[model samples]
Target: MNKKSCLNCGHTISDEFCPHCGQKSDTARITVHSLIKNDILGSIWHVEAKFLHTLKNIVFRPGKTGMDYIAGKRIRYNNFISLLLVLFGFNVLSYHYYEKFAPAQPLTDDVIYVKDFFSKYSKIILFVIIPMLAINAYSLFRRIKLNIAEHFIIGTVSLLGILILFLLSDIVSLIGLWKPVEKIFNIIDKIIFGLSILFPAITYWTAFKNSYSKPGLLWRVSVLYVLMGIETLIITAVLYEIF
Candidate 1:
């Protein structure tokens, strides 16, 4: 059989990975190990190695990720929407399994779930349009020439930041510090709120850095970041709690 050519580049290699483009090589072999390694595990992840790598770095280095993304280092990271879908899907599956094993006590209070749902979901539904619109408005306000799509992309990246933190917060919860875990999450929630505002604000700054003359905008930027972040968190919590 003729060897498969690199989809990324014209180079060819005989293994499962391309030496030149680093793209995974697809073959006709059908083995159980290959199926597990390639189909189940690699399908979601290996499809975008660079993206996973970038995601790792971004998770560790909070503000710097967006900066790097906007600075044209995107090849190393999954596209904003793609990454969100993957991470969000992982969260959903995780919570589902967790709930399956350790179900939330049936709500004794009739208003509890409802109130929590609204408290979280309402903002998400409202902000479904706000972040994008806000970005467009801010872009126009600053006279920076970009598209609404850019706003969407920036909004997505900002949202991912929140998800990463939330996931980290979840990991922290398993350390057997339930009370402290709750407090830490509360604090992180506030911090995330701050960061959300900071997110778009920085995204704006980065997007419009060429035109904006402000030198030290981090403080004001942080305010917006936090507020918007809270909104994002509300939405995330709603979705998570529901499913």
Candidate 2:
């Protein structure tokens, strides 16, 4: 019998995968089921794996992870922009469902407007804010000597750490409990908030220490905290005016 030829480039091959074009020798005919399983389901699984791996690194080794990605070691990590978009999408959907089903007080017109505005413009806001924070980092850590783009990567990862903390807080809030459970949830909420702030600060500090030869960890962290506070104030003012 004649051996199968590569479907992709018509190269004659004997092994499972074609050496010339890398097409599988036993490539199956296209069908609805094949498309759904191979294309759709496979893509979803791949994305999920990458997302989970990236999240783990960002949570546990944020400084090293960002540095690795910037240095072009990114096969295992999800694309930074794609990760941010996915997180933002989750935020929007979770907030929408929470408002619809949760037993929360009716939102005031201003509050509702603010929520809607942020929901619609969250990506744009982040694009603007992240670069600004990157610039702030560059100015504050001039001794580190990282370029603007490198600092942007650090900013992106730091923000992702904060977003993950926010999601955890949201998840905790979803727990419906009686008096004792409610008290426990409240305590958890406070703890999550504290960690949200503390963790990101640590992420930046460690990233800086690893990226450059730095000594004054406390001084650098203090300056970063001050920059964050200033940025938060500016953002609050902008939102106040818009709403």
Winning model by TM-score:
2
Deviation in Å, model 2, residue 44 alpha carbon: 4.0
Q: List, residue by residue over 39-71, the lDDT tens digit for candidate 1.
A: 888877766677667667655553456556656
- Over 66-170, each residue of candidate 2 has an lDDT whose tens digit, in order, gives 888988999999888778878877766766666667777878998898777777666666666678768877887787777999989988888788778777777
Off by over 4 Å in 2: 1-42, 106-127, 176-180, 211-215
Give residue 243's lDDT in candidate 2 (0 to 100): 60
The regions of model 1 sitting more than 4 angstroms off are: 1-48, 60-73, 97-111, 115-143, 177-243
